[model samples]
Target: MLAKGKDATAKVLIVDDEPAFRLLAERFLQQQGYQVVSTASVEEAQQQLGQFDADLILLDLALPPHFDPQHTLNLVPQLASRPVIILTGHAERDLALKAISQGAWDFIAKPIDPDLLAVVVKRAVTKHQLEKELLQLRQATPVSSPLPSLAGHSAHMESIHTLVQRIAPTEVRVLVTGPSGTGKEVISKALHQLSNRADKAFVSVHCGAIPAELLESELFGYVKGAFTGADKDRQGLLKLADGGTLFLDEIGEMPLPMQVKLLRVLQEGSYYPVGGREMQHIDIRLVSATNANLPDLVRQGKFREDLYYRIKGVTMETVALDQRREDIPLLIRFFLEQLKEQQGQAFALETGAMQWFLQKQWPGNVRELKNTLESVAAIAQQGVIRLSDIQLLHLDSQGGGADTEVVDSALLGGLDEQVKALEIRLIQQALQQHGGNKSQAARTLGISRQGLLKKLERYGLSHSSADD
Candidate 1:
């Protein structure tokens, strides 16, 4: 029998002429927690399937007057996406091979071993679920509202991804440069993930968001009474990130005095905390990012040229969404899947709406694209999504928010299945949102780090394949 925790809702269809055999198979599958349906022949099976959803089919070849596997093979095309496992006592080995060539998922020789049947059924059900996920990703959503994507077939993006794979293993300072929302932070997390230090801390600090007066203390800790507010000792980001990675975002905006201190840490592998007498030493990988042009900053005397060179051991750039237009549809699908968790249904863009999305300049880049998807999913119809649902020309007039109705809530799946699907998708999106930073993803999901790890395993979602 399949392991426990498998979806009890998985439906299996058993087609065999003998009533006793059919009864035995039905009882066996039910014991394994599958919803079972039985039919006596191909004709009855087809009729039953028209009103039932079956994840797997167990079809016996010698049914009724027909005793050929070819008859069952003929129904493969009409069965479409479902998996059909052939049950046969036929003597010809070549016939089994032919059955597989004709699209049978697998062949089980009769008198069927119940354990073997359970194993095949488990795998077939998993395959079907994965297929639905892939299919859901391809469908388009409403005008003005849309969808997720690490999706780009463009050579430029492909080259960037390739570079990430190659550069991730080396110990070097990496500078991620790109426009805001172009995924600079995403690449930073990828670098940390791909590197040998993947299991260690990936501490990130936003340089531009912090006040220069406090930025120094933020990076290099201060001892007790180091400052007016320093009632006790506090470790800086650098100390916290020992033996791991320190990500400095908006590096261009780092204060000159603080830049000198950072450069000292890079050169000496040690640092003096603010007003601290002790020089702490540690091993670390430094990754910095910026949307501003460092060369321009250096030329304008706002940034140190020496520090810029030290930080950019290697440079990578994430292009704007419009720069990789081929990825739009894929991103749309990804976003729709993410939206499904909260909205109870995923929406697709109509032809006119999708064309509009494909043509947009996307100044805000991937972030903007995702926000637009959320906006649209809020107002989309439950049935086939169309242009009018989002009120494309007048988006502001439309209530594209959580107030949106769930038109086809029941169409998605059973409540337990839906919850599991949502949990899986939410995990994926959260991982993407944090660039595979599990700690950050856990924080975003309001769960403990270990709890998130268990869930990731349960869903077969891996940190290594987060980008994929």
Candidate 2:
């Protein structure tokens, strides 16, 4: 089984009897830069398979007369390493169950949204690539060594390191809680590395990002023929981390049904995959992290009480960058050194820029800091990083009111209007600074594409005209 990564390009084979459907899928995937090959029948697909390699196989269940179950089953074993995703229209419970039992990566029901189909294809590619990379890594090295440690020496981090040392040796499930961009995942990795099962897989799952329907199979694995479109078997994250750690990031966002299933696994050390009969047992450690308060979730009955208890064997909170203001210089220096080494550019941070960085309230924390430094480093023409460059980087000034109040109060009518005016000013400043790329603008704002779109809508700024 593979662990997910950010950069995994998939080679997909679309096996659909409908020529129109195949063409549509091929066009969509091609637009996304994926290598897509399509065929109208299983025989044609098999011929292509013999000549070419595919990371993922998209198999449509109802493939006319000759391509029956026996014929398809014969081809499945041949794809020992590659994953096959089933495309189907069946909604009946029995048919879905049977499909899962037959060995499908996943089944997508008919009337698929093009955007969703593209996302599924991309996910399949990523999962297959992760599995391949992990298998190779396992074969290349001894499985008993620990994962790499996080490099940091600040007092706040030292406290976290100390907590990890105390918590990692046991089989207890740990809850590493912190705000987004505060290195919660890094802390989870540290706990895994320090643990006894460090040699085994340290599987990390981003619970909130994955769609609810697919989350169960992605975590627990699914049997072939379990659903209408399942053409091949898949091993879940729990099985992949059988003897190591399973880090569930954004645990707060996991749906209620999954929380129940997860709790059962924690209690019994066993779980049934999406379409499996027997309970699969695995000895593993759980390290869950989230920015949301699980306690509050428990109060609201959004999260399970038992699951919270199971995962909270040890709880450690990561301090946000703003709270640990003294560490700003250390972090800035570290990022600067990293930039200098990576870019091979001799650069010095201007005194004014360094002062501005220290005074600014970084709501996005460490991640925001690193990104700001990176942007400045990329744009700096001279050997020196200027205060002007720092100003151009739109650090979220919503929380910078302490220092800005005097100047802001002088220029503003009311709080809401003043903030909106400031936001507009900052957006303008960022646009001028970067010569305008919406994606870059979004990054500088520490917001998403959708969020930026809404902001642009609010300001009556046409997104197309943002560059100008």
Candidate 3:
């Protein structure tokens, strides 16, 4: 069930070739007091967009004359903040989700349920108005206390900003949890910069990336002749980060012995460097992040429960990109600006292409979005990104090698199947981007070589998904 929105002055542009269906939908929309404009094709819709200010769009997924379902979907940018509701004949849930992912706010199957249609339209219209209002308020408001470099205007992000501002100055140990590629490091950096010891070093250590045997030495460097490799008195991250902040990423992967040592440091406000008898006092804040379930690990005795409680003085949970979807456009804008700076050429997106980006589900979250946009920007024609350009990026197989492109075609499959196909494709692209170097590819993809190799095998990539 959905709430009715105060949608006065909202306009809906309907793109359906069928006259009877158009008339019916027009009647339905008019009955709800919405101004309706009906178009026979995407080209007509484009023309209508120039003169009419629409707040929403109703697109027929199956259009006449070579029914490319994604035809109108690719044109969403033209509508700007307008929400699009797709009308389709299929009752399949995947198709609906895919439609929404492709930029439609919602999709209703043919022989439309009037109640459902009305509710979806109302919600979409309400959302559009709210977003517009938020944008305006942001633009009008003074930046007396500006947020960190994390770019987003969604409610979830706003809440995060408020929480960070409140908690960052405090000495409480913070635990950040989110899926991989969701900008945990960025958040950690913000925390460090906002803290009282901003002038001192903000040392970051990846618990999972460093070897277990070397992690202790890396965290608490030893004195000269302390171990085989210890040639001089080396300052560890703990010493370097003294009077500042230490961000331990992937904290769930930290070894049990290291966890004990860390718990001791947290409890006693001091630590002894490896093979050193001297106790070193510390004055630093600890910020930890992990994609793994720390509580489950604690239950399994893999992660120390006491240590978990100590680190998680306050827990900040970051929502996935899909969950906070309205922020997509802001992120896209941020990335485009970055691209312009790097390329030294201005780039603008075509409306339809921008819509596709807004609707596309980023499994790798912000990282995936950034990489995809970078690939597209690399070859955009004369600094203009067309819908076809983005489509080509999605269609590009192992590498962008051929004039005639190759798409996996697995997108037409079930959701899980599409996901698997994309994983394989991304792995191939990663390897290709790194010139078939698996280690480099692994780093680029944000996975260990072992993890990457396991995936390569899973996707049958051992037999030439890459140059090797």
TM-score of each: 0.52, 0.51, 0.56
Deviation in Å, model 1, residue 361 alpha carbon = 2.7
lDDT by residue (286-338, candidate 3, tens digit) is 99999999999999999999999999988998878888887776777667777
In lDDT terms, which candidate is top? 3
lDDT of each: 0.70, 0.68, 0.73
Model 2 deviation from the true structure expressed as Cα RMSD, one decimal place? 25.1
Score candidate 2 by lDDT. 0.68
RMSD of each: 21.7, 25.1, 17.1
Over 4 Å off in model 1, which ranges?
A: 1-149, 340-347, 350-352, 381-386, 392-468
Models ranked on lDDT:
3, 1, 2
* Counted clashes in each candidate structure: 13, 23, 2
Top candidate, metric TM-score: 3
